[model samples]
Target: MPSRQKKVIFCIAGLLSFGCALSVAVAIGTQFWVKGTILCKTGAQLVNATGPELDKFVGEISYGLFHGQRVKQCGLGGRPFQFSFFPDLLEAIPASIHVSVILFSAVVIIFSLVAAAFFMYNAFGNPYETLHGPLGLYLWNFISCSCGCLVMILFASEVKLHRLSEKIANYKEGNFVYKTHSEEFDRSFWIILFCFTVHFLNILLIRVSGIQFPFQESKETDTSTGAADLMY
Candidate 1:
């Protein structure tokens, strides 16, 4: 490929990285805000004061219901506990909304990398299953390419489910029901990793694909060596 074409390809990869990272940052940041403490406290207070029966209904629609996944995880892991997954899934709606945003970002990342791989494959003219050479490069691009989203599915499933686990009830304090801080951050890190992985792979394809992987041609073709032979 011509130098100008390569430059354009690199620029596009840069744009993809920036867009995906910015999106992941915004989605994760905005999530907890809508499910803020005041909302939880208000629901809990209503449940405690007037009627426990009302609490069930309020919890069903609110973030409190999301904790069922956490309880279920523990139960599945041989921890003896009982909780309804239905309400947990219900409370998880806020997180479900947030995860949809993450999925959107993942989709973008996958497309960006696929474009990069296509560029590299054509530019270098390397065979798809390049034998005995530079397997890492192929693996690198594959992770961010079309296949990356399927890899992301595992993380998405675990984290999205964990979102439901964030809900748990604690003893009431004065006018408010107690708050137990959630674990949304843990899952968020993985989402960020996926975004970064996309950027990393795309950048690697842009920078490295032009050069033969696991092989260097510089020394054999040195210009100085040819000039010295003429002088001798």
Candidate 2:
């Protein structure tokens, strides 16, 4: 590729990485990761709430990594409440898994910024063959991608396997048990997924900038040597 074309590709990749970092940062601070309805199982059963009557016992729940909001309904009215994860609900939730998800999310943001900086450096500044160059780009992108994957997987496990929504709904409620009625990953969760995809695309952009994948050149050289030995 021409120098100008390579510069353009690097700039685009860098911009994309920076954008992803910003998006993930915003997602981490927002309460849009999971959104669902929780049904007050005890209340529903007590009143034999069937058909449309069950709606009276269902309320909304939405949460992110650090904090969230829930509306509790037990056939009376929706009662809104705000919650935090650090100290408030630690005893009720899977603190370890939840913390791991947050840690990986931070890693993704940090590495994404590093990748963007490296991309810009390769584009404009003089870059060496190893850490300061294409190899470093690949390393940073791979790390970001891996961390992003871990964030999604860990968070999903915390939500599904641990029954996060239900736990939050029933927290401190001794008389009524709450069950998840419907749940879906919201905007913030999808932003992380999109961020992961963007990093993968950056890897391809690096390839388009004329940098061979790590070890690919070495494998090609070894193949050429073996063919030459046979010819000899």
Candidate 3:
């Protein structure tokens, strides 16, 4: 790749990583500002003013992270699906949003793989460009690991707000309360973090998403020439 083209690709890589980081940061920061109050039902309403204040912050955070766009809600209502997102954005949607999220997620994954493959194909043959060979696979490794940070931020937001936890724990008990957040997905954030960690480390071992190829040239395959080694 020419230096100019390399610069453009690098910019794309930076944008991809930065955008994801921004999403995580916005969500967590919003959660810290506005986690809702824990109101004990059938007993006494906790009069802590901080409760509503916290809730407002959390609500804003959820809205911002989910982007107020209609997406599929977890199981419920019509066709086993309905509109869903952070509680604050639920009103923004109607009918069904569950199908939308699945479709969006699929697109993101497919494009992500395509981008990764592009990076891999270039990085393989040329040691200078192959991220692992010379440009440094560790840099891309850092990008992959950052996804885990996203999950941590999510968990912290929820942990700060105990309301979600209380609801799940109370499932066995007859007393049930409506949750502003979805327990199913948020609850598994930590597990996802674990997967990210393992995959990130695994990349270092296998070298970039298992892109294993001939690293050392055999005597018969040697193509090195003095001129080709010259730097651009």
Candidate 4:
């Protein structure tokens, strides 16, 4: 590849990495990872609240990794109450799984930043053999891709397969009772997924910048050797 093309590719990859890191950080901090409505199962039945009256029995819930808000419709025109995950709802499975998700997201962000640094160094600076060469680009991008994929898969499994929203809503304490009416992974979840896709696309960008795939080159070399021996 031409020097100009390589520079362009590196710049694009670096910008993408920065975007992914920023998005993951925002997702971690925002209390919008999941959003849904919860119903006061016991209170609704007791008051026979149905139809539009059921709106009075409905509550909105939105949460992230650390803290969230729950607005109860039954009281004070749906006043929102804040809650934290640790020490308050640590016993819940969703909370535990989300803790793992947050950890993996951090890993993804770190790896992405590292990859971006490598891209910039290779583009402009004098790249050394191991950490700033083509091999370094492949290694860093691979790690970033793997970490991003793990973040997406683990969080998706927790939300979809494990029924995270329902579990959190069903958690009870003393006289308080809540049941999940409907739940969905919100913007943060999709943003994380977009980050994953971007990292994966970076892998393709690395190849497009004239770096040969490592295993493919090895296979080609072995095949050439075999053909030469047969000729002999």
Instruction: Tell me, by TM-score, which candidate is best.
Output: 2
State, as a TM-score between 0 and 1, how close model 3 is to the true structure.
0.34
Tens-digit lDDT track of model 3 for 1-232: 4544554454444345344334433333232222232223322223332544333212111222232211212122111112124453333333133234233333333333433443454434444544444334444444446545544554444434444334322234354232344233332343335434543553444343333434432332355554456643
Task: Please report, in order, the local distance difference test score of every candidate based on alpha carbons.
Answer: 0.43, 0.95, 0.37, 0.82
RMSD of each: 13.7, 2.1, 14.5, 2.5
User: What TM-score would you give candidate 2 relative to the actual structure?
Assistant: 0.95
Per-residue lDDT tens digits for candidate 2, residues 52-79, read: 9999999999999999999999999999
TM-scores of the candidates are 0.32, 0.95, 0.34, 0.87
Candidate 1 C-alpha lDDT tens digits along 1-232: 5766765665566556556645554544433211222123444454464454333322211222112212111111312233443443334244454445446455655554444455545445544544312443444454554333543454345445543333333321243343333333333445555665765666465455364443344454466689889999
Candidate 3 wrongly placed segments (more than 4 Å): 1-40, 43-83, 86-115, 122-124, 129-136, 159-191, 206-232
Q: Can you write out model 4's per-residue Cα lDDT over 1-232, one digit (the tens) per residue?
A: 9998999999999999988889889889998888999887777888888888888878999988888888876533786788888777777766666777888888888988988888898888888765578777778778777777777788779877887666666666456577788888889988887887887888899899888777786798899999999999
Ranking by TM-score: 2, 4, 3, 1
Q: Model 2: runs farther than 4 Å from truth?
A: 221-232
